[model samples]
Target chain A: MPFRHLLLSLACFIVFSCKNETTPAPSKATSQRPDPHSLADPFNDKMLELQLKLKVDFDKKILSGSASWSFDRKEKTNEIIFDTDNLTNRKSDPWERRNPNHLYARTP
Target chain B: MTLGKEETPTTFTLEPRDSILGSALRIKLSPNTNYLTIHYSTLPEAAALGWMDASMTAGKKRPFLFTQGQAILSRTWFPCVDSPSSRFTYAAEIETPDGMMALMSAKNPQQVSPDGMYKFEMDKPVPPYLVALAVGDISFQPIGKRTGIYAEPSMLKKAAWEFADMEKMVETAEGLYGPYDWGRYDVLVLPTGFPFGGMENPILTFATPTVITGDRSLVSLVAHELAHSWSGNLVTNATWDDFWMNEGFTVYFERRIMEALYGAEYVEMLAQLEFWELEDEVRAFGEKNPDTHLKGNLKGRNPDDGVGDIAYQKGASFLLMLERLTDRNKWDEFLKNWFQANKFTSKTTEDFLAYLKTDYLEKHGLTANVDEWVYGPGIPANCPRPNSTKLAIAEKAATNIVNAIPATKEWTPHEWVHFVRNLPKKTTVETLKKLDSQFNLTNSGNAEIRCAWYDTAIRRGYVKEILPQVEEFLVGIGRRRFLMPVYTALKETGHVEDARRIFTKAKPGYHAVSYGSIEQLLK
Candidate 1:
């Protein structure tokens, strides 16, 4: 009976470990010595590459576009910060591995 | 926003906006996230961007657009880590109106794209501020294999001729430093509304049309911008407080390039003029002000406030002092190594001091008054004073002119500027009339000479004679360097109403960077 109980406990532990792997816990915010003129914590999550697709609108006198950024997460930080002024219509999209159209492809 | 390759929906929040620093955009990321895309638009009056109608261009046929992203203005256009320490490589697909040429601080195309879709890539990591763009009815003329000029078709030939020695300048700069790391050294002559003299934007420099004086006398501005390839672009200042690291080193390198091309006597005049400007700034700011220090404390102020003689001239003077103390060959070697070692990186004043202590100073077993020069307020006792025989002659002529001695007619633009700047303070309007009659100062084409003459004219109460030209200049030119003093002079000389009138007419033509200060001054 004891051997059967030990087997059942082992199975429960394995299932829990697999579930933990599939669903990562929410990351905690990291602290850094901020740049006085900027609120970005580049030390925690540093931008490595940027891809922009922008349209110049002469009549409206604005630049509307999407800025895709690739960065290296130095620690388990919850967020990445960027400086912006007088920018509007902002919509943020996080990467989704299952979306084929959202793969690392340049705008055509 | 999307994160990583999976295109998962992400959450973001635009934090409360600060009056000076602007807004901070924060986005949550998964543990595996490496990519995030933000879709946005810039407002019409974005501080870094200048949009001009056809009327503003030399051709007056097609509209023009340019961006000046130095200091902290880059954040006004794009969402990025706008700090100087944050460096990133970029690829951009910019769509413009058909028939317009688009260029960036990247690998540029000489011709306009047929579909109005232009692609640019900067393989090297650069601070976001250096990423620039311009779209207009522009054309390019190759000055050499790796040098060229870009301007409106109407102004192309004149610009090409004015910057004829651009190819030689690249070679001269390379011979001094390691290499012209940014492949091609080309200049884009923007419309009259360009606020600054020149913005060093990696491979492509955005220059003011004012620099095309037809005499090639102002090409030193080209050298100054090009020197930034090594000083400001390659190795950037980590913060605005350490801005001297960018301007001072570039100024020093610029003089060396000028010396290589125009000889030492010519550079001496240039250095002497800069020293005089520095002196005037020190007097205006009060000698004990901390802002006069090389490394300023700009924690709560706009970084633009730091863009003055303290960063450019005082910074250069400090480097010149170091060169004076050390052997030229050793100094050159140290500088080359410094550039090579710190290329594509941002550094602070402390970082440079530590490097100097370790590599150059300790290696030479030398001790210098670096502390007094950088930390202490005002110019130090050890500050090297550049003496110019040319300027001496101009000063004597200024004195002679007051004594009814006729001014020499065969002076270079530098000497003319020195003469105009050194005019007697107490000279009567009659003396001014005599000088203007001789020099035709009111009708001078050279922007530098015109600006200096106007400042003197405004101070000597000769505004009545030069008011029309002053209005024309204030209206036509948008360079802040020329605009600020002229406007200030008008205001200080009890001509605030006049300043307001001209500014009201000129404000629309000025870029936000230029108009913002004038708006405050007028207020």
Candidate 2:
């Protein structure tokens, strides 16, 4: 499969006719989350794998299970963070939000 | 059933985080602790789980339990790093009540287990948002070799009949892109109040029964969800910011599938309607609203807030423009290979741009206003204008309606929607009555056309006569797409009391998601 000559030329023509506002070929860090939505820094110790087992309790409308999360440490660290609760869960579940950084003081 | 903050497990802690709805669990890293585990149970009011009693189901004798994890709700159902970026393989053994069946977004069982314990497995890794579960007194009948339908016994035959083209849709999509990587594509026709139109849960697509209109006019939604098998379930957008990566690609692919099955003119009607929807939404969002951008800013806001017609329509329009830029043959090749190359991985908008440049643009000696399309606010000026010769005929007929002319007869629901959309503002009560008598739109069985006519009726201040029909439609269906505008229209037209009364009646049937959206609107 290939691009036809006439169409390819037409595409290039449109590009040159434009204001040429295309930014320089995006750098390696082209993918960005300057203001990241996630609180957990997956990079510090990347989660390599996970296994979850849950039982649905229809009467009580609860699912009870344990999730086994496996990850690798990028560098030796005394502690790690896992983002686990949602603040909007005020109505559904009983939980509270403290901070985005360390939920509690990191220990060595 | 909730995990207390103070009672943190020795291995990790489930604590709250600011700037969002859900909480994150922090687990301490240990050399010996290669796998850390947390035992958690979902609350009855868990966001992901929708527990419907026998009264709420089609069978009216069996309970149904389903999970919706999109945007960020999986954590409420099960303990995991509930993020769209974290892809993981999972297996589950759900213990259902006797005479029930359980299904997951995985390899599923065709029959109900004797003891009610059903097991499921998914070897391919998927984000938490794609995780889904449905349990009920459901039965399945194969529609094609690798396609089928699953519904409660009452809806089984009807659902199978409606989605009879499931096998052909898969073959058409595969012919355009690549083979259907997921083993089988099945659909679970959920009850009326199942919230969204469809959730692209890997092997089985959780769909609203609203799509079972008997006429198959709305099966395009099924095509849209099926296209997700490649765009979303296979090559995924790494973050919610690049949501258009998932939706935009899927919408574009969905249309092509529809075009394959029902010709370009049929698909063009939808594209034109999407353009109209996008225009209205952009204006509603205040053309410059950051929410109107393809790459959305959901910072400190629920990611779901970024979704609207903007993601689906705008994103699709941008891709449509690109396809026209280099022609279909080359564009199909680009997308087909792109899916093949990036299958089963999470990618960002930047990664897509890089791939688009080197793989297609540079290779084909082509360039597009990529930044203007993805990064800019509102619909890009260059978004392709959708036109259909067949739709033009309908549009002409619709245009004549304002001048005492009735809309064309024997029209598809799509054509009715187009006519309803083009109805002149301040159309007199006389005109509404005329259209109603001529079309019987209020009595129409089709939900889409019914809602479309209802919108006009409400705005024309002629809703009082059709009050029963209006209330029934409102209480019967819980699709937020249909619910929001009608409720808003009622609320704005000094009918707050009526809207509240109807919503109150419909509250129990509404999914948590639908309830949340309607509550915010009627608030």
Candidate 3:
């Protein structure tokens, strides 16, 4: 019974060793390569909805806004950007483009 | 809040319940009731705007907070998250007098009911510094497609006419850039002395009374604020550390818009003057300290400090240099690309440089030494030049003036004329001062010579001290017939008190337009 058990254990070890030997090592190029298409969001990788409120007093020459941004964290980035939405009150022009909010992640 | 010392340097914690980006926090601070629960992006106001007579202090008498007011006390009013880089959106519900009008960000225009209360909505996001509010009786004008609102009931008509070019400029800018994502544009004409130059608050801009040239030449400021629609309002800076991002980009954009409106010569001159102004700022700040970090300088200073000529001068020159290095087509493409890529987001100097270096500069065969110019002290040496096109044009003008001296007006001209016309290519301030002595209008000199002498003196910075004499020459010609630019510059430089005296002396000779314009500025 002892001899039979020893032979079974040896067979199992051989099978495991043979499987490990057949598996190829990861190549250097594969390890170093990062997907070029994965462009990180300037604000953050997390894509989330945001809400903002802007107020303008044309008479008093006062412009202000309130905003609540909802974003998720997928990966860390260098900075985040927010737009100044106060431009909604002004008339549009073809030459001067509209202003948009932005984000830049923190950089070490 | 109680404080405790730890020998092992207290470990920090972050509880960002109010943060927009999934509870991101940098530092650990104990929660305390004394700490105000601030929300949204807006200027900090200690007292609500209304007939709260008690909130009205002695400082209220000043015109638009030139001394101290709500805008100045933004620090005391709120926790002052003073970083322009930390961009986020804010949602606020302000409870004010039922009859008062409340405005913020880009919001749907509100309607006033019988209750006299108004509420506006701005769904677009914004930063804290760009937040603002003005409470007063105001009027509106529909001169063009866009609406112009004036805080003063009487100024609405004038405001409408003055801002007539808004639609045209915006349309032109949109063509050059992409379509403006933000819907409409508007201006709030508050009382005089707006503290800072003008805050380009997203859709609505808060303008200083000084900027209003009832004649509407103040369009440059409008163009500038409009340009900010893209530079500041759209692509915001990540932090105050990169103020040049907000200012430099805005200044460059403003000049581009102005160049589109005015001739290149005018824009070129403005650029030259702006460069000199930046030099002046650097010299002044250099005298005190070498640090040119705008954040350090703008601290406790007026709003204008945040946007001095350095932003214009250093910032524009940087772009001009970039244009020179990267050719016009490539530069334009780069700008368009950057704007498109980073629209409606906050950014930093590093991100800007990084993206440009990799995507634009590297791909387009340009230098990655942008940092040497942007982050370093002083202007870059041996900056790339855009050929001798501008210089050749200027030289041509000088040659034309020199060659066409009219045989009659050349040899027989006054000594002053000969001395000035024969001046070397470059004249130092001291050298110019010495030459000023040789000019005496009282002598028998023709109008051209006298005008030339006056121009030289003005260039040399003696126009103000010798205003009486400049006025004497100007009045003889009748100031009304003069070009508007020169007259405007002179009026701007001339002290209000001195102008009052000079105008009083020759009240009848003053052109109604010029006279009216000067009076408005003085007020």
Candidate 4:
């Protein structure tokens, strides 16, 4: 009975180590001062440079463009946030249909 | 969305919108991902963008577009951190309609692009709000080797003549602070509908056509904007709450530049007028209102709410007090060192106070009412009193208009403003009519004088005589500085119906910044 219990404990430890390796690490907390107006966490991940290629449409009064952001990721976060107002994404993604309010509910 | 040059697909989440702050765009990053690109478009009603039809422009031939992004409007045009705390270098390829030129707050092209494709590069890391762009039937003329003017072809000569002292202003400013880091300084004269007097977009300053008063009397607005190169563009406020740091410092620096170029007497008139404006604003907000404090609490509110005379005048008053405490040479040295130390960084109010404590106060072994001036409500007791001999003459002239008419012959715009603003509140409409008929105040080509005259006219019940001119002035100019007082007077004097009517006709032409304030006032 003792030998069997030891073998079972060893198997449990191996399974836990494998799970840890597969899962991504959590991001570390940042020390930068908070900006009440923005939702970006610039201390953790910040954009270093930006490249823009935009076409002006006077008829529509809109600017269609590709904004390429070169960033430095200080932490291990899987997501980087930016601020936008009155802009539309040209490309459709799976999350396009997701309710943003619902996603906000999931956020801390 | 794609990652880097490989164009690998990535996932992003668009958060729910807040009424004031808009929405947040969250993009997923892989373990090794360091770059991502977003493909998006700006909505027509973006608050920062002012898209004008040809009929609204000065030339009345080609359309014009400009952007005003200060105080959290940049996010409306492009996705970014959208906070002064974040700074980055940017490069762009802007394509415009054929025959039009594009300019930005970056290295610009002197001539129009034959193919309507223009490239810009801003190597220095600047706050996102300073990223500006303008496209229109614009032409450029050089004032000096490093200074120039951009305007509609029709207004080019007048604007260039008005701002001929641009090179001198830059040289004087550099003499005071440090080198003008941005390579070139240029001014673009937008259509009459441009809201503010001037926006200090680095490398290029967006000015209103209204400033081109033909006499160059209102060019202090240029000096003010140019001063921002050292105070605002170089050293920024970390958050909107610390906006006084940007504006107050610029106002002080502007006066210094003006004093260096013109003289003490000229700049003193400017300072005196601002002091009166500040006092009136304090009374309007009530002396104890927290918003009057230099270090504002703008959490959960529009930052623009804190941008009245308090930030511009009260903040400068605090600096003036410091200068009076220490000698001018010592203050100048301290300020020069302060700007050099924080050249490209955004600083909060606390950061500044700490720096001052260590660098200025401790070094000089002096103490000041810093807390009372910054965090306390209203203007402090120790505020400096600006005494302008010319303004005193203007005030005396306002007391007796008949005797003062001849004296006004040599009056500058500042003196005119002081005279009109100091007019007796109980003066009869007949007196106003006589004054207007003599001076042609209703038809004054100078916007500052016109705005001041209109405010007095509306208050003293003289609106009936100049009703047509008032409506024309209100509809023609979109500057909030000129619009607010006249509208408020109309409402306060029981003309809400008239105010609403004029605003309905004028709202579409006003930029979001101007209309937003007016809408709140009328509401």
Candidate 5:
């Protein structure tokens, strides 16, 4: 009975310590630590079909293109991720920032 | 952009994937996400795309833009699985000015239409490296039934004449290999400073104007790219480590194509040139240098670092030795079968060895030290030597020059390659002048011969009379094959000031591929 109580107390201490730990918010300054699941492509979860519509502006030296990717889901997964750097509405190249929903996390 | 299973819009981020290469993407999506749309643009400094203004082009009226996607640079231009292992068919819709036309490594439209938007389709599933695009005031001229050449309106006729034998070359290649899988093989002669000699983009080859020497002497560049249709475009290397699989096989096949069109002796001269360059590279990178290995360990490094003479010369030499070991007919048959089997698939060094073992060594009782050839640090001891009997004549003539015995001679491009390559290292300026007067090498239209002469002059400090011509050649052409040795020789001979001056003028015109190396060299 005493051993079981001690074990329960130790588990409680570990849980309490873990609960006190906090994760820093994601930022533009990328973390040096690599993500465990980071890979060349995230589209491998399903068979995919892609379409891209692009326009070149010589004066500005920018190539703006619209990419559409359609995938057929096969498994039971909540979220699917793709690799992107300058494709979002964050900064430079200004990707439809006039609208809302611009929350992104540096996947480290 | 639409995001997840509910078709809701969201954002994404780029995560650092590998250390040396570019980044990867991470986007969150819903479980049943059928489609995600992204509106994107490439920056002006995008590594894969090169934009040349009107001033930089032959036709100063229309601007030029082109895309180079090989060796993982494609990711910088756009987002995708930018690896050689990932392949998918693509179609492009490019909008250009009314007078200009856009072309890709795909089925190109025949004539210019009222709408400036050019639509191109590539049915073949190719890796990102092969997705090439070039847009400019381009015109095409038919050489033979299935072969043609494309260039600016001013240079079209000359390019057509220079590549008159394209059809014959293609037929000869088909006769050796199986068939010309890519329909309507065409050539695009970019501006004078179009980086490489020839890029093996499928359906169309992007070539440099330096190869249009009027004498058709440098058409070997064409042969090399045609050979790539089988080795690189059809059967590709999965990563840069197995680069020799693309180049070595292409070099061997290139020599065969040359031998079929031209004579054996002509190919022999070219082989001798390859030998000298390989020796120079092996000396530069010591015999024990890991970079000397055919199947290189190029992880976490610039893939371009592996683009050296070892993969080209030593790789071809290994295959040549294997050919010498087996019967000629059987070797040809094996190569034909190999190409047909691995068509449109990516391969690794290990995969090739397994094929060789199962397909040839075990079955036909053939033998080769496959590990020593591919995985070892240097050239194998038993590498088959290339013979250039005509080069022997040139060597004899070169020896005769030092002895003050002038032998009367008629020189072709092959002989010039041999004579210049065999020139005495310590030949005085006066001697070069005498040879230059006799052969007119300083004024030679051939880029290879001119490069050889400039390399010699740079080493010997005979810059008095040749400086003007050398400077012109240096600033005019941006091919690393021609520029690298000259700049190295200049630096070695204590002419950093002169090399820097020329590179300053030339750097703006060079593609990023050539610019990156020369920038470091001049620095």
Candidate 6:
């Protein structure tokens, strides 16, 4: 009884909607103005590669190493990145730029 | 429900969008993907190595690599959002040695690759705290049909043999709550250096070596972490501000499980010990910050740091009071319903209280402002105080135990030996003397009380008389059952030798209750 409204609506929608026929089309004015800023989700596609690794040795009482990571961001956008204050830039070879502030930043 | 949708990179334009809240650029998301990734690491510090593990007395820094060891440090082991609301499924593939086994937050471990790599996939959405990885020379022993795996070469057989009861424990939990969505469970014992004793990473758990007392009697830590699968891993705190959502509930559930498995008296004794632990911390000298106590400011108090007595004590106490406020029979049902509605999602103090009010107190024929009691701190001054009469009786018994020393008007070597064997049920001199004649009490005496007696005993020639017990006392004080008294005695005596022994034997234990004293003593 407490969820009567939700249950009633769901039941009616399921029973009536399943009877399938010609669907009503949106009006011309309403259909023409689509929102442009709506963006697609980022996690789709196997484009970027991600890997998390660990190295620990108890015999030597050693727990040390860096998390090896390699990924290619096809493009850039404002994403809530995972960054750490402890990261050190070891090397970029001959020439490489660094964006240590962003966890989701692209390699340069 | 379908959560967030992904989009193609080309779906949005190249231009950046402006926002009032600092930088605002919308991502062109994709529809196919339903996951997120986090990375962590650490930089060099001069005193790091010494602080990570200290052999010296005073100035020592030991080097520690939280994620660097597990290779998750690149993303900082903490959840990226700084909130528990951000829960996501993760799959990790570590390129480690073929000999070394790497444990991840995986429900299932896929086959080891021909290239000598392993890929582990975790199906449940887990918080960062619950996302753990351990790389070590380890092996596994499976427990029956349901409980999938337990990895620890040294203690694998012990862990398997000990936790054989876990399948039933989980079933009991499910019968009380609901079916545990995560199919199977296991525990991975990490090396001694692992900071925390146990990380309840859903199906897989990372435990500390220090906790595995070869006899495996102290397997309750396993129960506690397993309880978190429902209390924390299933439904998490939305923000660190609501740490109780995870810890408090877990403590409550852990106590219940312990009570069910190990008898109510043992659990009650454990609860009493937990209460005393909180009492000691609150009473620590110079710990004047009311905010630090339980009431003042909750902001900036890191989730990990706040796991001190405040979370364990205040949090568990809060849930106990909630149970008192509602019907006992209905409480379990309410929790199950709450989990059914909110599992695998982040929640706040207010959110939990609201549900409690609606589904519990109100429905159970009770009228109380539950929020005021919980969100407020230091306990209601007017709340029912513990029975002082009972406390007085116990105090009297304890005092008698303390005063009952039988050797030489002061502690002597022979007397010390007897005292350890005939340790007082309560601290009293008579109790200490009763065992002095026949048994080697030196080996059996509680560390805390002996330490308490150290100063007086030293003044009364007790230290010189029973120097060996003082040494043995320091080493034997690791048990939680005797830590409080031993700590008090140590503080009182200030004996350098005794202090050194504390350091030598200060191995962190499995229970959160055990670690409090060792870490505090180290500090």
Candidate achieving the largest DockQ? 1
The residue-by-residue lDDT of candidate 2 on B186-296, one tens digit each, is: 999997779999999999999998888888899999999999999989988787888998999899999999998998888888888888888988999898788887988
Clashes of 2: 16
In terms of DockQ, which candidate is stronger, 2 or 3?
A: 2
List the candidate 6 regions with Cα displacement exceeding 4 Å: A1-81, A90-108, B1-79, B108-116, B148-151, B209-217, B282-296, B381-398, B402-492, B496-523
DockQ of each: 0.24, 0.14, 0.03, 0.23, 0.15, 0.06
Candidate achieving the largest lDDT: 1
| lDDT for each residue of candidate 3 in B31-57, tens digit (9 for 90 to 100) | 210111112222222121212121121
**Collision pairs in model 4:** none
Q: Of the pair 3 and 6, which is ahead by DockQ?
A: 6
Q: What is the DockQ of the complex in model 5?
A: 0.15
What TM-score is obtained for chain B in each of the predicted models?
A: 0.97, 0.95, 0.61, 0.97, 0.95, 0.68
List the candidate 2 regions with Cα displacement exceeding 4 Å: A1-35, A44-49, A76-80, A86-108, B1-11, B17-21, B402-408
Give residue B219's error in model 2 in angstroms.
Answer: 0.8
- Deviation of model 2 at B426, angstroms: 3.8
CAPRI tier of model 5: incorrect
User: lDDT by residue for model 1 over A1-108, one digit each (tens)?
Assistant: 000111123233223323432443332222234467776776677889988888988888889877888888778565678887777662222322232122121211
Give fnat for candidate 3.
0.04
Q: Per-residue alpha-carbon lDDT of model 1 for B1-523, expressed as tens digits?
A: 3333344445555555566776677666656667767767787868899999888889998889999888888888888888899999999999999999999999999987999999999999999899899999999999999999999999999999999999999999889989889899899999999999999999999999999988888999999999999999999999888999999999999999999999999999999999999999999999999989999787767788899999999999999888877798888989999999999999999999998888888899878888888898999988999999989998888877767755477888989999888888987788888888878987898999999999998899899878999999999989999999899999999999999999999988899988988999989
Clash pairs, candidate 5, are A63-B41, A65-B40, A81-B27, A82-B25, A82-B26, A82-B27, A83-B25, A83-B26, A84-B14, A84-B25
- The numbered model that scores best in TM-score is 1
Candidate 5 overall Cα lDDT vs. reference? 0.74
Judge candidate 4 at residue B390 and give its lDDT: 83
Candidate 6 lDDT, tens digit per residue, B86-202?
455666655554554556666545233345466777666665455565544456666756574444355576556656777777876777678878887777655334445566777
Minimal lDDT window, size 10, model 1 chain B: B1-10
Off by over 4 Å in 3: A1-108, B1-82, B91-100, B108-113, B287-289, B293-307, B383-523
Which of the predicted structures, 2 or 5, would earn the higher lDDT when compared with the native?
2
